[model samples]
Target: MSRTTLTLGPLLYNWPAADWRDFYARIADEAPVDTVCIGEVVCSKRQPFYADVIPETIERLERAGKTVILSTLALPTLDRELKYCGSLAREASQMIEVNDISTIPALAKRPHAIGPLINVYNEAAAAFLIAGGAARIALPPELPLKSISAIVAAARNAVIEVWAFGRIPLAISARCYHARLHGRTKDSCQFVCEQDLDGLDVETLDGERFLAVNGVQTLSYSYCNLIFEARQLESLGVSALRLSPHTCDMVAVSQIFRDVLDGIREPSHAMRAMRTICSDAAFSNGFVHGTNGALYVLE
Candidate 1:
C-alpha cells in the first residue's frame, strides 16, 4: 500500500472564468492532490478570460504547500501563441508541462516537465526528454500499459505520471469543431465553444455517441477511470496519477484515490463511489489494457 502522488491537471473545459477561479481556489484549500497544473492547454482564445487570475491561483496553491506547474498549449500555430509559450517556459516557475514540440527548444536549457500530449512511446524518446531537463513525464493516455511500463523502467530516475481520470483528450486540429458543428468556419467561429462547459458531443453517422468537440481539441465520450488499476500502477513504481480537471467533485475524487492508495478502502469500493459521482458517463481502462481506448475492462 505504497502512496502514489495525485496531480490535479489543468482544466480542459470552457467554464466561466469565475467557475474556473473558484474551482482552483477550492483545490488549493481542500483537494488532496500533491501538484496543481494551471494555465490553458486547449484553445488560446480562452486564455485571456482566465489569464489575469492565473498568477493569484499559482500563489495560493504554492502557499498551500502544493507544487504548481504551468501547462502550455497543446497546439501552437500563431506567432503570438509561440511567444506566449516561450514566456511560460521563461517564467520563474521551476516546473512547466510542455504539450507542444515548439516548447522543447524554448524550454530545453531550463528544467521543466513534459505533458502527455508529446508522444513518448519508446525508451529513446523518454531518455531524450530526460536529457532535455524534464524532471517528470505524463505518458499519453493512448499508450498501452506495456509501453508505459517500458517507459517507466527507462525513466527510472525521472518521475512517471499517468492520466488517471477525465475524458481522454484524443486529438487536436487547427479547425474549430464547435464552429463546424454550427456550420461556420474557423475564421468566423465567434467563440462558439464557450457554450459547452464539458465540450460538445459529436455523434457518428449512425447516430451513435462517439466523441466530443472542444474547439481545436477532440476528446473521448467516455471518461477514463483508473481507480481499479491503482495497485497495479503502484506495483510498477509509478510516481503519480494525473487527474484532469472536470466539472465534478474533485475533492471527493481525490479523497477516494487517497483512500485507495492508503489501503483504507478497496478498489471495488472506490469504483462504486466513483460511479455515484461520475453521473452517467461510462468509465474505460482499455488503453491501459492495450485494447480499444473506450472499452471498459473490469478485472
Candidate 2:
C-alpha cells in the first residue's frame, strides 16, 4: 500500500470549551493524522464559545508536527461572519480552508484549501478553485467514485482529498433545527445543541434513524466509513483522506486508518474494529458507489 496522509477536520459540534481543547490536545499528542483543520465551519454563534482556545490548539498541533489549516464558516450571511472570514484570510499566515464561496475573494492569490462545502462537482469547478489559489480540495461526500476520479485527474497541481470518515453533511439551513426541535426560535437557541456531543438524532416517523440536526446543519445518520475503499481511493490519485471529528475515540480511529494505509491491518479487520468503536452509529459508503447515500456496498 502506498502512503496516504490522514487529515483531522475541525470539530463540528459545539462541545464544551474545555472538552474541545482537551480533544485537540489529545489528538496532537497521540493521533496519527498528518494535517488538522481547526476552527468552526458551522454556526458563527457557537464560535465565540470556543474561539479563545483556537490559538493554543493551533500551537499545540504545530508543536506536534501537524499541518494546521484554519477553517472559515460554511455560510457567511451576517456582516460579522463575512468580516471574520476576511480577517482569517488576511491574518492567518498558514493555509486557510474556504468553506463558503463568499470567502473566495478574500483568499484570492493566497494558497488556500477548499473545504467539502464548496461543491466541486466537475472538472471545471475544480479548475476554477485551483486557479483561485486552491492547493487542495476535500471532495463533496455525495459525489460518486467516477466523478471523484474525473476531478482528481483534472487537478494536477492540487492534492485531492475525500471524506473517509464521520457523518455525511447533507445540508445546511438558515433556520436552526436544533432550536426548532426544542421549541425555541433561532435567536433564542441558548446553545442547546451542546447537549448532543454528536448531532441530535432525527428519526423518521417509522422510528428509523435518518438524519441529525446540528444547529443550522443537517447530517446523515450513518457515519461514512471507507476503510475498505482506501486502496481504491489511493489508486485514483487521492493523496489525502479526511476524517471529520466525531464523539468517538479519534486517536483509535486515526490508528485504524494509518494501519490500513500502511498494510499493517486488513481492511476487513479495520472495519470490524471500527464497528466496535462506533457501535451505535451505522456505516455507509453508498454515495461514493452512486447508490443510496446511506447504504454500504463492498466491491
Candidate 3:
C-alpha cells in the first residue's frame, strides 16, 4: 500500500517562546512528518509572542523538506484576528488552512485547506469546499468511519485527512473561559492561559475527568488515538493523517505513525510505544467508534 502522509498539526497550547522554538527546532531536525501546520489557531492573543519566530521556523521546516501550512484561528472574532487571517490568505507562497468561514471570502478561488474546526459533515459539504478550491479537507475528529468513507469516496479531487492523534478540539466560543476562570474580563486576561501549557483540565463534580479548557476552546480530556485505525483509513482512500502538537515527544509520535504507514511497525506495537511516549495522556477512540467522546474503546 502507498504510504499515507503524516502531517504535524499546529501547536494548540500556549507554550513559552523558547519552548515553542526548541520544539519546532527538534521537529525540523528529526520528525518524519510530510507537512507541518504552524500559527496560532486557538487564541489570537497568543500569536504575537511567537509571530517573530514563524518566518524562521517556516524556513527551517522547508529546508527540512516539510510542507509548512499556516493555520488560522478557529474563532476569529476580533477585527485584528480577521485581518491576520486575511493576511495569511493572501500569502500566495504558502498554503493556508482555513479554520473559519470568515476567512473563506479572502481565499476565494485559491487552493487552500479546510481545517477540522469548520463543519464539513457530509459529502455535499466536502464537494462544495473542493469546488471552491479546497485542495484538502481534514475531517472533524468526531466523525465515524462510515462518514469518513462517505466523504473520501465522494471527494476524490481533495485529499481527505483525518485527525490521527492528540487532544480533539471540541468547540470554540467567544467567551474566554481561561479569563473567566481567573476572575478577569476578557480584555484584561493578562495572558493567564499561559500558565497551563497543555490546557487546564476540567474535572466533573463527581471527581471524574471531564473536558479541557484553553481560552475560548474546549478540548477532549483524553488524547485521540487512532493508531489501530490508520491502515483502515489508508485503505478507504484517506490521503493524510494529522498529529496535533502537544508537549509530548512529537518526533517519536510522528515516527510511530510513519512506521505504521510504511508497514514497518504493527499497530499493536505502535500503541505500546505510544503508551511509553504519552504516559500521562489518557487515550480515546470513542468518537471514531461512534460512542461517547470521553470513553476509550478497546480494539
48-109 in candidate 3: lDDT tens per residue? 89888989999999999999999999988879989888987986489999999999999977
| TM-score (all chains, Cα) for each model | 0.97, 0.98, 0.98
Question: Candidate 3: where are CA atoms >4 Å away?
Answer: none
How are the candidates ranked when ordered by TM-score, highest leading? 2, 3, 1
Q: What is the lDDT of residue 21 in candidate 3?
A: 93
Task: Give per-candidate clash totals.
Answer: 0, 0, 0
Off by over 4 Å in 2: none
lDDT of 2 by residue, 142-212 (tens): 99999999998889789889999999899998999999999998899999999988999889999998999
- The best candidate by lDDT is 2
Give the Cα lDDT of each candidate. 0.88, 0.92, 0.91
What is the lDDT, from 0 to 100, of the residue 157 in candidate 1?
74
Error of 2 at 70 (Å): 0.6
Quote the lDDT for 2 in model 1: 40
Higher-ranked by TM-score: 1 or 3: 3
Q: Which 10-residue window of candidate 1 scores lowest in summed lDDT?
A: 87-96
